[model samples]
Target chain A: MATTALSSPAASGAAAAPEGAMVGGDRKWALRWAYFFLCLFAAFALMPPLYMLITGLKKSSEISAATNPWWVYHPTLGNFVELLTSRAFQIFFLNSSIVAVLVVAITMAISIPAAFALSRMKFWGSGILATGVFLTYLIPETLLFIPLFKMFATFRDWTGIELINRWYVLLLLYPTLTVPFATWIMIGYFASIPRELDEAALIDGASWTQTLTKIFVPVALPGIIAATIFAFTVAWAQFLYPLAFTTSEDQLVLSVGIATTLIRADVFNWGQIMAGALLGAAPPLIIYAFLMDYYIAGLTAGATKG
Target chain B: MANIAVRDRAAFATTSRPRGSAREFFRQKSTVAFFFTLPLILLIAILVIYPAFYSVYLAMLSKRMDRFVGWSNFTFLFTRETFWMVVKQSCIFAITAVIFKAIIGFIVAHLVHAIPNEGQRKWRGMLLVPWVIPPALSTLAWLWLFDPSYSAFNYVIVALGGDPIPWTGHALWARFSVILVNIWIGAPFFMIMYLAALKSVPAELYEVAAIDGATWLQKLWYITLPMMRNIIAITTLFSLIVTFANFDIVRILTAGGPIDQTHVFATWAFKLGIEGGDIPLGASISLFMVPILTVAAIFILRDINKRGERI
Candidate 1:
C-alpha cells in the first residue's frame, strides 16, 4: 500500500513522456501554473505549525514587546526550560500520562473480549449489543457529563465517596469516550481474520480463552496497536471531561490546567501559554510523526470495516 | 472424501444433539461467548445505559428537585429568550464549520495529490500536524493569539496600519474566532480522508479521461467528485454531528461568554447544568438536540452501509 504511492505515472512519465504528452503545450503550461498555486495553498495550510514553532521558540520579552511578532529576534529556550522545570506543568503532565495509559488499558480489557464475542459468537442479543455499542459513540461527552456529574454528586452525598476533583475520576470517564470506538474497531479487526483459524483451534482441544490469548492476540497485533493508539489519543486529548470533573490544582490535566490557571482576567501570558501549549501538544505530535500509519489505520478502521 | 464426509456427519450429529451431552450443554461455545462478553455488558450498562436513562428521568423535574413537572422543563427551555439564540448559533457553527472544512480539506488534499508521489508522504505528514495535536491545547494557542492584551494577530493588523480587530471581544468577532479555530482543528481530518480517497482513484481512469481530451477541471468535476460521492456524504455528515456537538473548542476558547453572544447548545447546557445547578433543564435542553443529530447519524449510517455493500 505504501510502495505504490510514489511510483505513479506522474513521477515515472514526467521524465519519459515530455515529447509524447506535448499535444497541447498550453494545457501543459496551465498544469504547471496549477501546481504552483496549489503549492501556495499547501504552504498556507502549513503556516500554523510553523507559527507555533516560531512563537514557542521566541523569548518572553520578544513576544511581549510591540515588535515583529512573526519573526523571532532572540530565540531562547527559557520558556521551554520554565515549562519543563515547573512543578505545575509536571503534575499536569503526570496526570495526563497516567489517565491516558490507564484508560487505554481498561478500554482494551473490555473491548477486545466484547469485540470477539460480537464478531465470532452468535448469541441471542449480540446484534443488538453491537448496535448499542455503536450508538454510544454518538452520545457526545457534553450531554453525558451533566448526568454523570449529578450521579457523582449523588454518590458523594449518599455513600461519602467523592469522585469529583480526583485524577482517577478521569480514568473512569475517559473509557466512556473511547471504549465504544475501540470495540467497534476491534470488532472490524477480529471479523477480518479468517474464521478457519478459529475453527481449527476449536477442533484441537483449545478452549476459547486459550484460542483467543494464544492464536488471535498474536496475529491481531496491528489492529490492537491501531486501537490502542486511538484509545490513547482520545484519552490524552479529552478536554470537557477533565474540566467538568476536576477543578483542583493537583488533579488537573494539561487541558484544564492551562485554561484555568494560565489566563487571568486581564492578563494573557502569551509566551508562557504558547510554551505550555507547545509542550502539551508535543507528545501526540511526536506520536503521529512516528506512528502515523497506525493512527490513520485506526481512524479509517470504520471505513475499512463498516 | 467419503471418509471425511462420514467423520463430518458423525461430528455434526454429536454437535447437534440437544440437552444430552454434558460437555455440549454446559460448555458450549455460546456459554463461552457469554463469559467473554459479560464484562463489556456490565460496563456499558453501569456507565452508559444507566446514566442515559437516569438523565431522561432527571429531566422531568424543576430546579428545586421537587415533584415531577411533566414537560415543563422542555417548555421552559423553548420559552426562554436565550434558547433560540443558542439554537441559531449551534446551527451556524455546525453548518459553517463543516462546509469550510470540506472545501479547504478538498482543496488541500487535491494539492497534496498533485505533488510528485515521492514527496507526497512528507507533505502529508506536515499537513497532518494540526490533527495530531489536541484541540484543547491548539485552541488555547488560538485564544492566546487573540488575547486582548498581547494578541499576535492584533499586532500584525496594527503593523499593517489596520485597526486592531477585537477577535473575541465583540459578538461577531468571537463567533468568527471560534469558527476559525474549529476549522483549523477539523480541516486536517477531512484532508487526510480526501487524500486517501484521491489516492484510491485508479490512475487508469485519469489516463483514460486525459486521452479523451478532458481538461483538468473537467476531469476533477467528472471523475474525482463522482467517485468520492459516498465518502463525501459520510464524511460531511460525520463532521456535522461532531461540530454540532463540539464542546472543547468553544469552551476553551471563549466559554460562550462576553455577553453570551457565541454560546452554542453544548456550552449553554454546561452553563445551565453546572452554574445554575439546574440539572433537569440542562438535560432537557440537550435532549432537544437529539432529533437533528439522530437524523444526521442515520444518513451517515446509511451511507456507510451503502459503501459497505460494495465490498
Candidate 2:
C-alpha cells in the first residue's frame, strides 16, 4: 500500500503530484472508514438472529453452564431435532401455513380486480377512491386489532357462530390487514402498464374482464407475486391478533404459539423457543432470500411510486 | 334562423350517435369500474370502515357495549396517571426510535452506496435479515438476549469488569431496550428505502458539486438531501404511524412492565380490553391514536397524490 502510494506520484509526472497523493490518501481512508462502520452496523443488525441460532443449538444445560454464551462447547442438533418432531410445533407450523395461504387467496381475489378497475377504468371519484385505498393501507394493524376483536365478538353474538377460537376464522380477519396494501401495490403496477395494449383490446371489442384476465393479469405477474409475498408474510408474522383471538392449543399459529407455549412459568425453554422462532420466520426469510428484488421493488413502488 | 340552426344541430347529434343510449350507459367504463371494484369496496366496508366507526362508538359506551354512557370512558382515562405516562412514553418511544432509525439508515445507506455495486447486494441481504424475520419471533430472540439472569451482553460486560445492566428490568433501561429493539428491526427498512432514493439521485450533481469545491458533507446536504426530500418526508411520516401504533416489540419485550412505564397505546389497550376486560376503555385508548395516525395518513396520501401528478 505504501509502495503504491509512493509509485503513483512518480507515475503522475505532474508538479502537483504530492498534493494528488495526499488527496488520494484521504479518499482511501474515507473508504476504509466507510467499510469499518458498514461492518460494525452489519454486526449490530445480524447479531440477534445469529445469537438466536447460536442459543437454539445448545441445550438448556449448556446455556446455563456458565460457559461462553457466544460459543457452544457441546454443539448439538438436539434442539432442532426435538422441535422438528414435537407434535405441538407441527400443529403451529400447519396452522400458520393454512392461515397464510387462505389469507393470500382472499387478498388476491379482492385486490386484483379492484386494482385493475381503479387503474384502467376511470370513474366519477376514482382519484378520491384511490387515495382512500392508500390511506387504509397506512392504517397499522396495531390500531385496528382491538376494534376488530370487538366487531368479531358482535358477529358471534348476533349469529352464534363461534369464531373466537377457530383458526380458519382468521380468514375473515387477516384480509383487513392484507387487502389494502395489496390493492395499493397492485394499482401502482397495473398503472405502470402502457394504455395502448388495453386500449386496442377494448377497441377490438374485448370486455373489461377479458382485458384483465388476458392482458393485465399475465403482464402484472411480478406485482401479483409481490402482493402475494406481502400478504403471506403479514399473515405469517401476525402476533397480536392470534394471541388475542385464539387461546386454544389447537388453534394457535406458530408465532403466538411459540411465545406462549414454550415460556411457561419461569422455566424458559430458550432453546426450543429460539428454534420455534427461526422456524416460524423461515417462510418469509426464504422468500426474501429468493425474491428480494421483487420484494424491494414492491415495497418502494408502494411507497415512493404511489 | 335560430329554429333552423337548432334543427340542424339535432340532426347532427342523432346521426352522429353510435349506439342506443341505455346500452351505451350499461357498457360505460364507469359501470365496469364500479362492478370490478365492488368486492374490494365490500371488504373495506365490512372490515375497515365499520370497525373504525365501531371503535369510536365503543369509546363512548360502557364496558359491555350494551348502552352509551357519553364520553365517560374517555373522561375516566384522562384522569388516570398511567394513561398520562403512556402518552408521554409513546411519543418518546416513537420519536426516539424513528430518529435513530433514520440516522442509522442514512449512514448505512451511504456506506453501502459507497461500496461497489456488486458487493452491495450481499451486504444488503445480510443486513435485512432482521427485517425479514417476524418482529414477534425476533423479539423472542431479543427477550432471551436481554434475559436478566443470563444476558449474553451482561456476560461480556461483566467479563470486562463492568456491572451487568438490567436491560429490561429498570424503567430507563427498559425504555432503552424497547427503543433499541425497535431501531434494530426498523433501520434496515429505512436503509433500503434511503438506498433506493440515493440510487435515483443523478451522479452528475455530485460531480458538479465536487468541481465547485464542495466537501462530502456539503454535497450530501445540498444535493443528496434536497433531491430526496420528498422520499425523506414520506418515509418519516410512514414510520411515525407504524412506530406509534407498534405493538409487537413492546408486547414481547417488557409486556409494558416495570410499573407500566413501557406501555404504548396498542399494548396498553390490549392490557385493558382483552386482559383487563374493559372493552370500551381499551377501544377509547386505541381511538386516541386515530387522530395522530389520521393526520399522518392524510399527509402521506397528499404527498403520494403530488408524486403521482409529477409522474
Candidate 3:
C-alpha cells in the first residue's frame, strides 16, 4: 500500500501501455477527468474559507455597499485590528486557549495511561473496555448536552456551587467530547507496537510504569502527537458543549463567542464577524497546516485501524 | 530507585507468594491495569453514561420537572405538527446529507487516487480545507454567503441574469442551504477517509483485474468497493450519527429557521430544551436520536468486530 501510494500514476499509466494502447488511452482520459473533478471539488471545498477571507478584509461600509461581495474594493485590516484590540474578543481567545490547553492536558493524562493499560497490560475486561471507549466516543455531545445542562443546574441547587454558565465548566465537559477518541487513537498506536519491546524492558527489571514511560511513550510519540492534536482540535472547536454550558460574554469560548456575541439583535457586523470567525478558526487551521500528515493519520486511523 | 525496588518486589511476589494473596493481587497486571483505567472509567460514567441515562429520565419527566409524566412529552411531540416536521426534516437532512457526502467523497477519493502521486498531496490538502476549519466558524462564513440580502452567490447569479436565490428566506431553500453547508464541511472528511481506504487497496489486484480485461467500472465495482466496504460502511454509519445529531451547521446556518423547516434532532432539541426552557421536551426530542443511533452503532460494532476477526 505504501509503495502504491508513493508510485506516480504516470508510471502506472506507462506500465499499462504494454498491455494495450486502449488501456493506456483510457488511463489518460481517466487522469484528465480526475483533474477536472478534483479542481471542481477543490473550488467547492475552498469557497467558504476564501469567502471568509475576502469578507474579513472589507470595511463594514463596503460590506453594506452595493458592490461585488466576492471582491473587496478597499481591503483593510481594520476588522482584524478591531477584533484583536477588543476586550470581548480577547476574552474569547483567552478562554478558548485555556480550555483547549487544559482539556488536552487532562485528556492526555487520562487517555494515554488508559490506552497503555488497555493495549499492553492484557488485563481482565481490557478488550471490552477498549471497545467501550470507542462506543463512548460515538455518543454525540448533542445527546448529552441537555441532560448535562440539567445535571449542572441540579448540582448548583444541591451544593450551591454553580457549574453552568462558567468557563471552567467547559474543562469538564469538553473531555466527554475528546478523551474517548484520544484513548482510542492511543490504543491503536500502542497495540501496533510489538510486545517484544515491552517484554524486553520488563525482563531488564523495568517496572510497567518505567517501561511504559521509557519504551512505549517514545516509540509511540507520533501517535501521542496525533492524539494530542485531536484532543486540542476537538476541545478548541467544540461548539455545543461551550454553547450550552457557558452563555455569558466573559464565559464563552471562541466558537460560541464568535457565533453568538459578535452579532447583536437586528444588527450585523459582517466584517468583524468574519474576522472573528477566521481568527477563531486559526489555531486549529494552523496546527493542521503544520502537522497535516499526523492530523489525517489520526482521523483515518480511528475508523480504518479500529 | 523506587521503580527498580517495586519491580523487584513484584518479581519476588510473583515467584513466591500465593496467587490470590493481597500483596500478589495488588501486584497483578489486572490490578495495575484497573488503576490505569480508573480515571477513564470514572469520566465516562460521570459525564457520558450518567448523562445518557439522565437524558432518558429527563425525557420521562413533566415539563417543569416537578412530577413524573411518563411518555407524555413524547406523546405531546407526537401531536404537534412542528414535531413531525422536525422528525421528517432531521431524517431528510441526515440521510440526504450522508448519501451526498459518501458519494462525493468516493468520487473525489477516486479522483485523487487517479492523479499523479506528487500532485495528490497538494490536491488532497486543498480539498480538505473545509473539514479543517471549525464548523461553527466556517458555517458563519456560509451564513454570510447565504445572507438574505448580500449573498455573494446571488451576486454571481444576478450578474448572469438569473434570479437571485432566496438562499435562506424560503423554507426549501433554507433546508437546501443548511444541507449544502453540511455537505461542504462533511464531504471532505469522507474524501480523506476514502482516500486512505483507497490507498490501502493493493495495486496488484487492479493490475490483475486490468490483465483480465476488466473495465474501470468493473474494477471499481469488484475490487475498490469490496476492498473498501468496511471503511465505507463505518464512515457512513459514523457520519449518519453525526449528521443526525448535528447542531453546528444547521444551528449556525439556519437556526431551524424559515418556520422551523430545517431543524434536525440536535438543533430542535436545543431550541426546545435550552432556549425554550422545556428541558423535558428537549430531552424527549433528543431521545428520538437513540433508536437510529443504536441501530447504526450496532452495525458499526459488527463491522469492526468482523474486521478484528479477520485481522
Q: What are the per-residue Cα lDDT tens digits for candidate 2 across B1-311?
A: 78667766875675468866875655667777888899888888888888888888888888877899999998999999999999999999999999999999998999999988989999998888888899999999999999999899999999999999999999999999999999999999989999999999999999999899998899988999998888888898999999999999999999999899999999999999999988889989988888889888888877877877887
Q: Write out the backbone clash pairs for model 3.
A: none
Candidate 1 or 2, higher TM-score?
Answer: 2
For residues B1-311, write the lDDT of model 3, one tens digit per residue. Answer: 79778877877766685566776676567778888899999999999999999999999998889999998888899999999999999999999999999999999998898889999989998898888899999999999998889999999999999999999889999988888888999999999999998998999999999889998899989999999999999999999999999999989988898888889889999998999999999999999999999999999989988888888
Task: Assess each prediction's global lDDT (C-alpha) against the native.
Answer: 0.83, 0.88, 0.90
Residue B192 C-alpha lDDT in model 2: 91
Model 2 chain B worst lDDT run, 10 consecutive residues:
B7-16
List model 1 lDDT by residue over B1-311, tens digit each. 78667767877787788777778865688888888888788877877888877888889987877879988888877788788889999999999999999999998888777767887788777777778888888887777678776677788788889998888988899999999988888887898888888888999999999889998899989999999887788788888888999988888878897787789888988888877888888888777678888898888777766776787
Which stretches in model 3 have alpha-carbon errors above 4 Å? A1-26, B1-10, B13-26
Best by DockQ: 3
Error of 2 at B275 (Å): 0.9
Model 3's DockQ?
0.65
Compared with the true structure, what per-residue lDDT tens digits does model 1 show for residues A203-240? 65577877888988888888899999999899889988
* Native contacts retained by candidate 2: 0.77
Complex DockQ per candidate: 0.49, 0.50, 0.65
